[model samples]
Target: MTAPALPRHRSAALAESLVLVGRSVRLSRRDVETLVMAIALPLLMMALFVYVFGGAIETGGAYLTYVVPGIVLLCVGFGAAATAPAVADDMGRGMVDRLRSMPVAAAALVTGHVVASVARNALATGVVVAAAIAMGFRPDAEPLEWAAALGLLLLYVLALSALAAGLGALASSVQSASALTFFMLFLPYLSSAFVPTGTMPAVLRAVAEHQPITPVIETVRGLLTGAPIGSAGWAAVLWCVGLLVVSSGFAAWAYRRRTRR
Candidate 1:
């Protein structure tokens, strides 16, 4: 009887999560300004780097090609950060309290925000890729390479979205939740995103080289440009997997604490 009940419980949890995911996506659609900014800021940054700063930078090739991967990651970061406010709003407005009284699974709330974030990032990424191509950024990746790059990016987005949700659960207000995620938006600038790390000062270079963002950016850039990825690919996989595990656990713990009576 217990074994039979477990599967039924799991199925109910999944159905609850799917319903919450739809709710989150609808909320995102109504927030047109945030969605537009999430998609637009990356395009504006890509253009700035390619047209203005691209002429001044020496990347040993087209700056546009070297910079698109970074811009793509930046777009993902922006899209994921929006999850924090959504989660926080739910927490602050007593929605979590209302849901707690229902038969819904507690984890379903965070899962909804996470799934909605991934969908938003996917759309923003597609728009950024189209814009990059229009701005003369070309990639030499075959289909498999493209697949690998996108898969890794999806992992990174999942990790960051979970992290944002955790931060949101701990925040006292929606504004604080947004502030907590600002680091995600700024992290790529310290990586090999816009320029080579070797060009930086020695300390900054070390920080850029050792951080998780650098390896992820390097792996994507290599896969897209047909350059040697070396060990960056392996490092990227490990980093994304590690972050996902840690962030998912953190989100679960935070949500439980926040919703406890």
Candidate 2:
């Protein structure tokens, strides 16, 4: 059988996605628990790590500088994972069905989720960074370095949000989607986020060093500290680009399958 013809009006789809994105952003702002997790929790964790654990870790009196970049990624990762429950709730409540019945592009729903996720992540990152600064984390990076770091974060958020959207679409319930995202919450722990992966045991170290989160963490640290990033920076770029392409395709496929007439 011939495949269904795709939505042809790109302009209309873009407009619809923007409207939906705005709606999602408003809803998120009103979600007190989400606000706590996205903005407050990361800040709390940063404070706890820097104050509670800083003395133990040997970072040459720059522990805050060392850990702030990881905290930024932690904030963004948690925010990206938040998209799964939002998408699953919309699906469970028949919002997807209602949207599919309309004349809008089906992909617009996913795009809206991604755009909202990026906005939320950006806000959360800012909050975490501000908190870090207040807690005595200072970086001497120039404007261009900050721009590059933010750009990397945007790409990271987009990729993970798309993946979370796909996971949400595949889930049978909001609970399941939320459960699946807990892994994302735990991923940073296994990376070079807290301490260097070299300090990990052999097996854990190998896994931590090879995972996607490590290179991204390293890149952020390099950009913030003005240290040489070497191949880790390129690896981060590759991971973001690769994940974006893969996750976007997966999300689109899951959406189509979930909403198929």
Best by lDDT: 1
The deviation in Å at residue 64 for candidate 1 is 0.2
Shift in Å, residue 141, candidate 2: 1.0
Candidate 1 per-residue lDDT, tens place, 43-80, comes to: 99998999899899998988999999999999999999
- Residue 149's lDDT in candidate 2: 90
Pairs of residues at least 3 apart in sequence or in different chains that clash in candidate 2 = none
Candidate 2 worst ten-residue window by lDDT: 2-11
Tell me how many clashing residue pairs each candidate has: 0, 0
> Model 2, residue 58: what's the lDDT?
80
Evaluated at residue 49, the lDDT of candidate 1 is 92
Per-model C-alpha lDDT, please?
0.93, 0.88
lDDT of 1: 0.93
Q: How much is 218 displaced in model 2, in angstroms? A: 0.6
List the candidates' TM-scores in order.
0.96, 0.94
